[model samples]
Target chain A: MPSDSTIQVRQVDRYRWLVPKQGPMRVDGLVFADRRLMADVRGDQALQQVVNVATLPGIVGHSIAMPDIHWGYGFPIGGVAAFDPDEGGVVSPGGVGYDINCGVRLLRSDLVVGDIRPKLRELMNQIMRDVPAGVGVGQRDLRLGPQDLLGVLEKGARWAVEHGFGVPADLDRIESGGALSGADTAAVSPRALERGRKQLGTVGSGNHFVEVGYVDEVYDEHAAHVMGLDLDTVTVFIHSGSRGLGHQVCTDFIDVMLRATAKYGIDLPDKQLACAPLDSDEGKLYLGAMNAAANFAFANRQVMMHGVREAIERVLGRSWTKLGLDLVYDVAHNNAKWEEHQVDGRRRKLCVHRKGATRAFPPGNAELPAAYAEIGQPVLIPGDMGRYSFVLAGTERASQETFASTCHGAGRQMSRTQAKKSVRRDGRDLRREFEEMGIEVRAASFATVAEEIPEAYKDVADVVDVVHQAGIGRKVVRLRPLGVLKG
Target chain B: MEDPLGPGVREVEHTADVGIVVEASDFEQLLHRAAVGVFALMYGKADADLGPTDLFNPLGTRVHLGASDDQGNQAGMPRPITVVGSDPAAILLKWLRELLFLHETEGLAYRRATFDVVDEERVSATVWMGPEPTPAACEFKGVTYHDLDVTPGVDGWRARVILDV
Candidate 1:
């Protein structure tokens, strides 16, 4: 086991590096990045985390990382790992992270940039008022009791729709129809329930936001059309997760996995990588609880989308349907799912864990909605609020080489403390900086704006270019932020 | 005035989240100061003149302060809370998590904290909490064991914690 500084990396292609199998590794590790990005990747402990992921039981192919890889709890952010159940595969709570099914949702509108420009500030103010955000801020209007909360845990987005939060059609565009099946409410702990009761539609804090942007570039006109994205059209992106409930789920299960590791006779390099065999009782319990939490997140985003639609309608003097504010796609970046894939030329059932990675199923995959059958899954990569985000379509190469996963975002280049310190040292007002770029910023506190300055993150265009050039994902459209709301 | 905890907590560099390093001459002081660090990160510093009554009384029945403090002031002290874990590391983890839970659920922010018991497994502490003056800059989701370490060297006991923000 070499340190990050001494680790050996062999560049296999223009955008991929192979960390060959060594001591105690069941398979090799693969990192997707070009030379420039790889330098930053090598400078951190993320590569070591990649190596650590390879030692897990029943790992297949390679422990893969997207270009946005960064040091995280156990598996590196933007990491993807899969295991075959028939081969003693295991499930790890740390691999899915604390915020289960933390994801992004994009909404497209018929209105163009011209229509939104004059009303951007008013719209942002309306959204900030409608959407509950910041630390421990619960939705004032949508508190749930135990029984209704149970329905949310069980039905996911369906519950929100049934409660008049969203339309039934909205679920069609969401991942897994906006709900993961097999969610057992019994698996959810009382403490998690208490934490979740008031947080259903809230955005919480740190990196989560609601951004109003415009599609500025379309690289693939056909795919862009399929996704309802046109050049200069208005769009909204919602980034959030299950909040306190999901955190409690992960905390509860990490303790279970810690005990399960010794019982299952598994060895781990990091305690955060605690796991249990997929067939074991502990694994089954975690999967049940995790699915419930993921469902909570799905419903969370669904409800937030409803609030966004209302805000737009209230500000623009039109109904959401008249505004064409339809859901483009909702995709989870942090999750574990059971899916069938071709492994060793044989169809096998495996549990795929994508920590900070998006599912980018290619065209014609069974899981995709009929509308997206010919164009592939829509992959939304939101960058810093002041810069740009991206819309990409999945490629066959992604399905074959990376377990249908791609980068989640630009990835952080600096620590929060470092970003804040640099802002103070340079005497820069981040809000003014964004304003200079014609971007409107609204946040609960000044510290958040400083810590999330564009410089704190890598250029998202560079990250998308790597995946596009590597044939994992094809560029479809690019979005530039006009108004941003931070928790 | 000199600080009792003595230069205890400092921020550590992390790419995606917040990290902190806490040091003290003894384990009990380490635990007490770590509480201070977590609260400070969550709600900033408390005013020096604010007492426990000024903090905890607002929460009413939600808070239970067990006994009087060193000054024989019942209003200025919080009830003792005890937690048991497998080891010192686990005990520290539990202690921090309990505080986070209180903050998220009850919106309580501690003005001061003290540890009465500190061994390998069991811990008892008292915290004087008040309503947060403002929202936190960011929310810490949970504490992770990623590269977590608690060690005692010649100078004092030290611990590194990575928080999921």
Candidate 2:
């Protein structure tokens, strides 16, 4: 929850609420939540953050929050907003968050639950060994030189593909083809570069993981069939980001933006909301650096995905190709991108920021792959490890109403300490608990597992229901974990 | 001089991340205490308190000593670090950033700190580095400036900062 809360909200309908424009807000705040979710939200200051975001200069529409909204640093988690650069729209690093491009990728396989049920433990162990995880762990064997690092910053997942990590075909399934243009390596600092050097293919600690699961249910058979998600088919979910590099990029730019905010005479509700006019040099430089960092994240996940395929190959004694492992979709939940969206019946180029949210571009959007053009983008929503995750599709209503975005995941409802304390109080052993459910578990720290107990987040089904019912997101499939690896 | 207000660090609650509340008699003490607390969050306090084996190190094992250095493994040389920022909060954030970088790169945890210079814009300190930490329970991505607070009170100085865990 936020440190402060004094905003008032009125219910707009069963699944939405409105925080009317007041104070310095340029627009009203719109939040999609049921009463139960709103009750949880009202306890936190997330509503105030919605208001805070609405106060930013050049905000095009109502500051928005999804049902999964939770308290976050500057803008609330699950927040989405777009700004018009022509109207003094400013870019704020805080909106993109510290882990730039922190995202998830789903890979579908031909293997069924029966094929890997017995060897799930071995498969998980192999992946854990192949992928370096935990705090302060880095890829000792894959350190990148300056030039190689530059390539990663420039080409993103393409660099990984060229370096023999994965096939070229995998790129098409990724958001922005796994690399955003306009990346300026010159804008990335030496510190940021050094931090990212050894972390290229490693998963850093904290809410990051590689989960092996299977499709337990399919809600929209056509959408699922188009995405190759069939009932009982196995899958791999990789959730990670650019590691230290992204953090340092955000850290470095927050300072730059702070000064720019003062220089541009932009008044902010909070210092952390520091920003610069989109056309300014500072803004452009940050965009370049942020894009580079984001590319690194795209490449990071790509490399890790390859490692998982190799791990599966080693465990099952079959080539990944024979196993029919294919990229399903990769979506970044934290990022800001320039896109053209219709506003008031006119196409206006806008910079949309999705923090703790996912882009759910409607069907027929040109950005989607041809195979998915008729089904819309596949929105990967990973729930808590113990429960289930949902796969949703973008909708026309989403593009028209929310600038094409939806809830990212099951947002946290408990603080780390609170979660840990509850676990201790119950004398629960998370590993054993998960094992009892027939799920194989491996982690760098049991403390992390305890902190991320299933109850730590709201039931993702509840959150997804709101978006689905609101017509912003269309449900496609649901996945249940067979084995999990936590960083 | 014995301080009237005890210097210490306490974990504070946040919905998604971790935070620390640090209290010290002065700015330099505040930074030192906060560093210890942050490391404690990642690595447990078991190492922070030197064991009897740590006191009698026949192998001359390198040890990182804290502000109260009375025990354990061979004392290592102090490393000098200088950081400049626009304000005290910025300085604290930068200091923490450097410490985190050292932890990620050199595996050095905070042991002790001696301030040679201090001000809102610049801070120079000679810090004792510890050996590689044990497997961390958690990893902090970076320190966040969200709702960051550094204030002087009648009792002493207090700072509250959040970590992107």
Candidate 3:
């Protein structure tokens, strides 16, 4: 039910939409989209998903949708909803999504952009070989036992660092020191555990990729300098997530949420938004499993980052340590956390749900690592293989309105089916076109290649511009792709 | 229907092999003739002689045939379910998704399936679920419509799909 249809929307800015609460909705809904981005959502169900999320119990402020809004299983891909535990808020698998903690990480190096321009082929080849690509890809030489896998899940990048994947201090640049607390290996399912055993370092198929980029522009000189990046420095961005283990954790919880939705007397518009009170058993269980998977994703990226470092070392015949290959930052797009945000003139812990959106905490927030306290959290945004990626910093306005969340990536403008059909009709040979564009492409199947065609997505620059202009996230450095390896 | 694929379907990129796509003049032929393709994909075998069981809809939308058997694997006695749908897209998607779902949830995997279809929009075909695939059987990750089409061609109706390895 639309809850009496009294929920009103008022344009707060060119890029933001407000949903005012009237009926059963506890809080209003906020959507970030400019006139250009808003056009894509006109006939889409994602907007309806935003409205549907407003009816959940204990929702705080407004149900927020980021700029890259697309219809997903439950919440819109670029959606953020905060639930208050004091009022019996809930956690839903639809909120966290199948690929739990499916996130992106950025790696910066001291190498100038011009240094590796000629050797792009060799670099892509070496990275592809070092970091195995495609479905169920694993390092045959590095299988782990149950204890080892659990340790990886619990320790995140620390596990990779312990195994000589990278130096010890790389942890300072990662989110949650590369491992979010409260990850219990025992809460993880055996199938999830087994599937993740060999997938620690592999970049799984579909939308996942490893891209080598060059700093194209510097928007914030001080922030870039603090982050050890200069205009024209080479960087590597790893975009992947917790793989199969995360998928199962979500599947396991959807069953619980489905029943919880009905038992708790919550009337919902979509089954995908099935949720239970945050204090309930199902909620706790899903949170535990989701955090475990999120930790797995963190560890997964750490392992891949280590692999990238190794490949760079092998290609250049020098130690990555000697090259100052420091990690920039990593952030998860799909997650719900207990965070203290002021609502109704009081501060309370709300379960913030950022599905396909990243938290954009402003500067001086205690969560920031000691180094980034002055500049705020490092926000990494990756675009299509054919376009440019961005590095942004959080702003105070993000705290006031959005509870510190921003768009995830270039939103999909077309369905997968439409993408495949369109790319094929354009007479564009994806592999050849990618090669001509100086990008190496690999996939388990040809269909995934077509679905991932660049034309299928909106220009990420447009999406990032809305956030940057909106003062939610500010651009720091822009990075353009030199080569990309897709799943 | 005429396709340029080879006669035998064994393996592709990695493990988890053995499946085929069939063509037809219309929806009827698409479902009716797909059984032949299913048998061909499953090492040219079938459950044609198996008795009728039941037709059920798990998702409450599509047609599904759930047939089971209490057979003793090396471990002990276990049961398996086979589901079939009329729409080739629906059937193939359901078959693959169900197989993966069972593996993830119920710890069950299917090595082979005997699929039969009915052409009508409301009528899905039949499926005889078989034992979980052994280590030797290839697992198909997913089916994709990269260059997929079901339009009438020079010969009949055809489609192209890439199976995720």
Native A-B interface contacts kept, per candidate: 0.50, 0.47, 0.00
Question: Which candidate has the top score in DockQ?
Answer: 1
**Which candidate, 2 or 3, would have the higher lDDT against the true structure?**
2
Worst 10 residues of 1 chain A by lDDT: A1-10
Q: Candidate 2, which segments miss by more than 4 Å at Cα?
A: A1-5, B1-7, B46-77
Residue-level lDDT for A74 in candidate 1: 94
Q: Kindly report which residue pairs in candidate 2 clash with one another.
A: B66-B111
Q: Model 3: per-residue lDDT, tens digit, A402-444?
A: 8888888997776654664576567655666776777665443
Model 2: per-residue Cα lDDT at residue A368: 95
Model 3: colliding residue pairs: A28-A62, B16-B138, B16-B139, B17-B138, B111-B133, B117-B125
Q: What are the per-residue Cα lDDT tens digits for candidate 1 across A1-487?
A: 1138777889999999999987888989999999999999998899998999999998998899999999898999989999988889999998999999999999999999999999988888888878877776787777798999999999999999999998999999999999999897898999899889888888888999999999999999999988999898899999999999999999989989999999999999999999999999999999999999999999999999999999999999999999999999999999999988888888888999999999999999998999999999999999988889999999999999998889999999998877877876787655557778988877766677777889999999999999999999999999999998887
Prediction 2 global C-alpha lDDT: 0.86
Q: In model 1, which runs have C-alpha deviations exceeding 4 angstroms?
A: A1-3, B1-6, B44-80, B114-116
After the best TM-score superposition of candidate 3, give how far the Cα of residue A70 lies from its true spot, in angstroms.
1.1
Q: Encode model 2's per-residue lDDT on A38-114: one tens digit a residue.
A: 98888877888899999999998779999999888888899999999998998999899999999999999999999
Q: DockQ order of candidates, best first?
A: 1, 2, 3
Give the lDDT of residue B38 in candidate 2.
88
